[model samples]
Target: MKSGTRHPTGYWAEEFMRPHQAFLAEGYQVDIATPQGRQPVVDELSLSLGYNDNDQKSVDDQRAYIAGVAALKAPLVLGKVNAADYDAVFVVGGHGPMQDLAVDPDIGNLANAILSNPKKVFSAVCHGPASLLSIFDKDGNWLFKGRKLTGFSNAEETQATFAGERVAEPDATGVPDRI
Candidate 1:
C-alpha cells in the first residue's frame, strides 16, 4: 500500500511489471494492499528500468500500469477488504513481499479463498508466493502444500543481491513455505 524499498535480496523486476499491466488492461480493478496499512517502500533494485527493461509491448503495457497505479482509488486497507469481491488474485512479487506478505493473515486468507475454487486463478511471482505458505484448508493443513507455484528461490535471491540469503524463499521447490 506504500512505496517498496531496495531489498537486501533481489527480485525479478519484469515479473512484477508484467501482471500488474495485465490485470489493469483486463479491466479488473487493481488494488495494492499490505500489512500495517502504511505506504510500503518499493525495492529500488526491482524498479530499475534498465535492468528489467521491457520489450516494446511490455513497455506500452507498463505505461498503462503506471497510469493505473497513479489513478487507483485509495489503497485498500488489507485488513478491511473482503475476499468475495475479487474474481481472481495475483500476488505481485518483490523482495519487499518477503518482509511481510508471508505472515499476513489476511493475505493468507485471501489465498485460501481463491484456492478453494479451481476456476479461480491464484497466482504470483518471485517472492510474492511466499504468502501462499500462510494459507490453510479447513483442517488447518497447508493449502498450497502441493500446488504448483513459483517464488523467488533462495539461490536466486542470494546470488543476485548484496544480501547473501533470505528466509522468504523456501529451500525446496518454488512452492510455498509450509511444504
Candidate 2:
C-alpha cells in the first residue's frame, strides 16, 4: 500500500473481491502482500455504503472478509515474495499504486519476472497498471510500450465529486505521465 495515497475509489476494491472470492472457492490459496510487511491502509471512502448501494451484501462480505481474514491482517512483504512460487500475479488498482508500486524496484522486478515467464500470468486493473511503469525490457524500454492498456481516466477523475467537490487535484499529472 502507498503510504501517502488515500481516497481509493470504493468500486475498484469491490471489483477485486469478486475474483478473490472466486479463486478461494476454486480451492486456490490467496496470499496478500505489500511493499513492506505493514497492514494496508484502505481509503475511508471505500468503506462507505454508497459504494455498494445496489448490493449491500457485497459491502457486508468485504467488511467481513477484511475483519476475519488473517492473511490481510499481516500481508507478506513484497520483497520476500519469490516469483516461482506463484502461478499468477494480480495487481489490484486504486489511487495507491501510483504513489509507491509505480517506482518500487522490488515490485518492478517481480512484475518483469512474472511477465517474462511464459507459464506465469501477470495482470493489473485500473490504476494498478501504473506499476508497469517500473518494468523495463532488456533493451531498457517500458514493458508496456505499444501495448493497449486502460485505467482511471482523466475525465473520470475530473468528473468525480466527493463530498460535492471535485476530487481530482488541479495540478495532478494525468495517469499516462504518472506511469
Candidate 3:
C-alpha cells in the first residue's frame, strides 16, 4: 500500500490458505510461486485476535499450517515456471502483490499463457485480481477489458485501513476523508 500508512502489509493469511487447503483436499498438486522463488511475507495483522474474531485457535492453526507447508519454504520462481505444467493459476490476494505481481512482466506473460488455455484456470481473490491487470492480448490491450471481475473494492479498503483507527468526521468538502 503506497498510502502514508506505516503498517506492514503482506499477503492475507486466509486469502492464501483457504483455497490452498481446498485444492489439496481435492487431490490437486499445489505449487506455490513467487516473483523471486522466496517465501512471501505473511501479514501478521491478518492473524491478530481482532481480525480472527478473537479466536486464538484459528490464528494458531493458520500459523501452524503455514509453518508445516514445505512448498512455501521454497516456492517456484514465477519467471522460470512453465504455465502449461499447471492446470490452474491462483494468485493469492495481498497488499504485497500490488507492488510486484501486478507489474512484473514475467507474471504478465504467465497470466496470458494461463488465460489462453481453455483447460487452465485463472483465479484470484481480494487484491489478487490486481495481478490480472498485467495480462494483455497480443495487441497490447488489457486481456480482461470490459469483463466483469471482482477484487478488493475501494469501500472494503477504506474499512480495512480504518478498522481500528480514529479519524475525524467528514468535512464539508464532500471528499469524505483523505488518506
Candidate 4:
C-alpha cells in the first residue's frame, strides 16, 4: 500500500485478478499481501466504465472476484512472507506500487528471496514492475540488470497526460522511475 490512500489503476488490478482466478482454479492458493498488510485502494479512474475499454464484463467479473476474496480486505505483511512457501510471486501493477513498493527494502528482500529459488517463477505487469527496482544483488547492483522485461513506460504515461499531474510515478528513472 502507498503511504496514504494512493492506489493502482483499476485496469491493472483487473489484469492481475484474471491470472489470480486462473491460479486458484488450478488449485493454487493465492495470498494477497502488501508491505504493511493493509487493504489496497483502487484508482477511481480505473473503475470508470470508459476505462473498461469496451470490456465491461471483464471489469464486472474482476469486481465479483475481488468481492469474494476475503484476504484482500487485510493482506499478509510482505516482510512476514516466507518465500519457500510459495511457488511463484506475482506483482500486480498500479501507480500505488510506485509510491511504496518501488522503494521498499522489504519488497526488494522478498523479491530477491523469491528469485533465488530456481524453481520459482516471478512475474509483474504494468506499474507492478516498479517493485523490481528494489531488488539488488550482493554486489549492490540491480538483480534484474540484464534481464528482458517490460512495464508501464513513461512515454505512455505522458501520452495519457499523467506527466505533470498528481498521479503517482515510479521511484527510479527512465520508464520505471520512482513516483
Candidate 3 on 1-179: residue-level lDDT in tens? 34445667788898888998999999999998889787888889889999999999999999998888889889899899899898899988887775567777778899899889998898888878778767778877777665666666676877876332434233343222322
Please report how far candidate 4 places residue 159 from its true position, in Å. 2.8
Shift in Å, residue 65, candidate 3 = 0.3
After aligning candidate 3 to the native by TM-score, how far in Å is the CA of 51 from where it should be?
0.8
Question: Global lDDT of each model?
Answer: 0.62, 0.68, 0.78, 0.73
lDDT of candidate 3 at residue 153, scale 0 to 100:
64
Comparison by TM-score, 1 against 2, better one: 2
Q: Using Cα atoms with residue i matched to residue i, what is each candidate's TM-score against the true structure?
A: 0.69, 0.78, 0.85, 0.80
Per-residue CA lDDT of model 2 for 1-179, tens digit only, reads 12333444322565456677888999988897788866765544555677668577777777776667688679899988999899888887666655678777778888888988899988887667767777777766777766677766666555544221333331222223552
> For model 3, what is the alpha-carbon lDDT of residue 126?
85
RMSD (Å) per prediction? 5.9, 5.3, 6.4, 4.7
How does residue 101 of candidate 4 score in lDDT? Answer: 84
Q: Write the per-residue lDDT of candidate 1 for residues 60-168, one digit (tens) a residue.
A: 5544554455423345677776677777777767766765777788887877877677788778776677777677678777665656665566566457653442353
Q: Which pairs of residues collide in model 3?
A: none
Candidate scoring better on TM-score of 3 and 4: 3
Q: Which stretches of candidate 2 lie over 4 Å from their true place?
A: 1-12, 54-57, 161-175
- The deviation in Å at residue 89 for candidate 2 is 0.3
For model 4, name the residue pairs that clash. 93-128, 169-179, 170-177, 170-178, 170-179, 171-177, 171-178, 171-179, 172-177, 172-178
lDDT top scorer = 3
